[model samples]
Target: METLFGILNNCVYGILALLALWGAYCVILVWRRVGQVRFADEEDQDEFLSELEQALEMNNYGAVSELCEDDRRALPQLALYAVNNRNIGYAKLRRRVAERFQQDVLSDVEHRLSWVGTVIKSAPMIGLLGTVMGMMGAFANLSSGDKVDTVQMASDIQFALITTALGLAIAVPLVLSTASINIRIRKMEDLVGVGMSRLFEALKFAEA
Candidate 1:
């Protein structure tokens, strides 16, 4: 019975280790993607918006299209869509650009984020499972024999506490990372809104 309990404890440890590794991978991927979409600095932000304004003022569809294509981020794509489909008229062009961005860029970003959320939620449950298993082992030894094995009981209790601690350790940092990523995503959404507004202004400039 003790041997069986040991095997189960080892299994739980292995599973938690795997979960931690997966959480780490998710963080890395999210951070890299956020970096790509975010402006490098205040100067870069000013320059990018300034250039867009200039292109719109000059009624230069080619330049706007080129700028959007060159940027690998989210906001620029809106401009690309706007400039490329300008002949379709503003309302239809706006709808198409929005649909395309929602389906593509937003989906990609959220897919990775969903995994991070899953890990944060499940790791604690997994730890609780380990805790329960450890307690069962400790209690079983007390009931199964005339002479209780204090050493084994202590070990089981220790395992239970350790698993719970590990679970929290895995969860806490991920929660912070997830929050940071969410903030960045919101910023990206704001940038997209600003870009879309400017795009319409440019269209009006062209009409004028």
Candidate 2:
């Protein structure tokens, strides 16, 4: 029984280790998002258009270089759609561009970030299971009609609390990360709106 509690303590250590890994992942998510949000912001879009202008004027590909530097994954292609369909009226061009982004790019960002929410919601349930099992262990050890080992009951209680703590540790930042992702998603959606506006205006000028 002594060796068993020791091993269970080690198991708790493993759970805590997983919690640490999740915390690290949240840090990574924030880091990656710093750049992504920059691109998503409509205010930050001038650099892309400026480069595209340079690309057109000098007949070089440096605008492509700027986008690649910022990890602006889909801007170049979307810009191309606007350029190519400039004569079609911006409305049509805008619709086509929105269809592509909604179907593939934005949807992909949403799907990838959704894991944060899933983990946050599930961790507490896992912790509840741990507490229930720990109670069962404590009751089983109470078999004797004489007296229960206070030390054993305390150990079980500790395990229950520790597991619950670890679960919340995993869950809290996951919720924060999901909120950050939602902000980025909205920013990107707004960028798409701006792109459609530009596409339409350019087409209207061409028609005139």
Candidate 3:
């Protein structure tokens, strides 16, 4: 019985370790994504839009196209789409930008954030399961027979405590990291929203 409990304890520990690693990987993914899609300063976006307007007013299609090629951010890319389809009218171009933003930019940038959230929620639950299994094993050993080994029973209880601690250890940091990532995402969304609005206004002016 003691041997069986030891095996169960090891299994629980192994599972908890795997969950910790998964949580870490998810956090890393979120960080990398945040770095890639974060927005630039509002001033920079405003200046760029002003310059782009000047280029469009001058009928410099080449300059407008060049802006698309030179930049990788969502707003500039959306502007390129708008500039390329100048005859499509503001409403249609705006629709295009909205579609592309949802399908390409927002989806791509926020996909891994969902994974981070999954890990944040899963890690603690997994840890709790481990703790429950350990506790169950501890109690089972206690009721097994009169020849119960106190050392083995104590060890089982320790396993339960350790698993609970491990779960919290994985969960708490993930929660904090998730919060930070969410803030970054919200900031990025705000910047992108403002920038896109400005871009569309510039494109409308150019169309006029």
Candidate 4:
């Protein structure tokens, strides 16, 4: 029975470790993704927009396409889409661009963020389970016989406390990271909004 309890406790620790790793991985991926899709600095954004607007003002659709073609940033990708479908009226183009950005870029980020949230919520519960199991094992050892092994009991109690701490440890950082990532996500959305407005204005004139 003691051996079984020990195995169960080990399994719980293993699970907690896995959860911590998975959560960290998700957070890092989201961070990188946000960076990729958004401008890193205002200067870079300004430069890119200036070039794009110049291309548009000159009625140079091919240059506009070339400008956006190789860039992975969200704004450029959307610009490429607009240039490709330039004959579509501005209103339709605007609507479709909004939809495409939401569906393609934002939705994928949101999906990954949801996984991080799941980890945040699950880690604590799993830790509590480990704590409960540890306590039960400790009490079971005590009641099994008058000859209680102090060392074994101490180990069980330690396991309980450690699991509780570890669970909180996993969750706390993720909570903070998730908050920061959310801010970045919002910033990306705002940047995209501003960029799109500029792009559309240029497109309106270019199309005319």
Candidate 5:
């Protein structure tokens, strides 16, 4: 429609829509880091769990710390509890300490990635609102007659079209970002599960 075309011509709305896409690039970088995050292999996880139990019963917090991969080691919660609470039962300590550990890792990686989903879902809707506002401007600009208010009408039409196009542009990438973020989250869950199970089991073995 002529109305739609005229609204998009001004291009101001389009520029704003384009900027919304920057969130997608940010998502991609975050996803890449999520992928880089380390997790123990399942068998290694089980073995480590077994060893961890041994270490705990032996009262060796240092060995427990050494068993953790580097990124995991950075989690202060991982070793701090065992080091601080020498009197705590090994099984209880394992449960509390490892749960905190998993939560910390999730917060660092997968939880942070969730913000991308929020941005992705919101950006397009923002663009759409801009489009609607633009269209309203178009209708308001016209005089009662078909003899148009040409100047204001063109500006209004540009805003409407650019915003709709921009909304779609932002949305497509946002959808992609959401998908990527979700995948990273799943990976984090899987990895953390292995680690936690091992940590708990190792403590159980130490008790037995």
Candidate 6:
């Protein structure tokens, strides 16, 4: 029984390690994605918007499409969509662009974030399972013989404590990272909102 518990404890540790790696990867992916969707700096955003407005003012839809096509930022992508579908009129164009942006960009980010959330929730539970197995192993050892092996019992107790600690350690950092990532997501949304407003204004004039 003690040996079985020991094996299960090791398996739990292995699972936790994998969870940690998976969480880290998800966090990095979310970070990279948000960075890619947003502009590198305020200056770049300002420049792109200025150039787009100028193109729209000239009533050059081709220039607008080309400009947006060359840029990979979220706003530019949405702007391109808006320009391509400008014949639908502003009201429908605005609604469709919003839907597309939400479906394409934001939804993907959210899906990645959901994995991080899962790791955060699951890690602690897995750790607790390890702790339980460790404690059970220790108790089994204690009961197995007339002369108790103090050394083995101490090791089991240590394992239990370590698993609990490890679980908290894995979860806490991820919780903080998830929060930070969420803030960035919100900021991205706000910036996109502002950019879309500007793009829509430009489109109205260009179409007129």
Give the winner by lDDT: 4
- Can you rank all candidates by lDDT, best first? 4, 6, 1, 3, 2, 5
Q: Give the TM-scores of the predictions, in the order they appear.
A: 0.92, 0.72, 0.88, 0.96, 0.63, 0.96
Say which prediction, candidate 1 or candidate 4, comes out ahead on lDDT: 4
Clashes of each: 0, 1, 0, 0, 10, 0
Colliding pairs, model 5: 6-157, 6-158, 7-156, 7-157, 7-158, 7-159, 8-157, 8-158, 9-158, 53-202
Candidate 1 lDDT, 1-208, residue by residue in tens:
7788889999999988988999989889988987887676546666787888898788887888777787887767667767777889888888898898888777877898899889898889889999999999989988996799899889999999999999999999999999898988888777777667876877778778
Predictions ranked by TM-score, top down?
4, 6, 1, 3, 2, 5
Q: Which tens-of-lDDT digit does each residue in 1-208 have in candidate 6?
A: 6677767878888989999999999999999999998986667787899999999999988888888897777989999998888899788888999999898789989999999999999999988887887788788877886688889888888888888888889999999999999999888888888889988888787767
Q: Which portions of model 4 show Cα errors greater than 4 Å? A: none
What global local distance difference test value does model 6 have? 0.87
Writing each residue's lDDT as its tens digit, candidate 2 over 3-108 gives 7656766665676567557655754665475455346455657666655555545544455345444545566567665566556755676787888877657665
What lDDT does the true structure give each of the candidates? 0.84, 0.63, 0.76, 0.91, 0.60, 0.87
What lDDT score is found at residue 1 in candidate 6?
63
Structure candidate 4, residue pairs in collision: none
- Model 5 ranges off by over 4 Å: 1-22, 25-29, 40-61, 67-70, 73-87, 108-114, 144-146, 149-155, 206-208
* Segments in model 6 whose C-alpha atoms lie over 4 Å from true places: none
Which ten residues in a row are the worst by lDDT in model 3? Answer: 33-42
List CA RMSD, all candidates.
Answer: 1.7, 4.3, 2.0, 1.1, 5.4, 1.2
lDDT of 3: 0.76
Per residue, candidate 5 scores C-alpha lDDT tens digits across 163-191 of 66776777677677677677756755665
Q: Candidate 4 — what's its lDDT?
A: 0.91
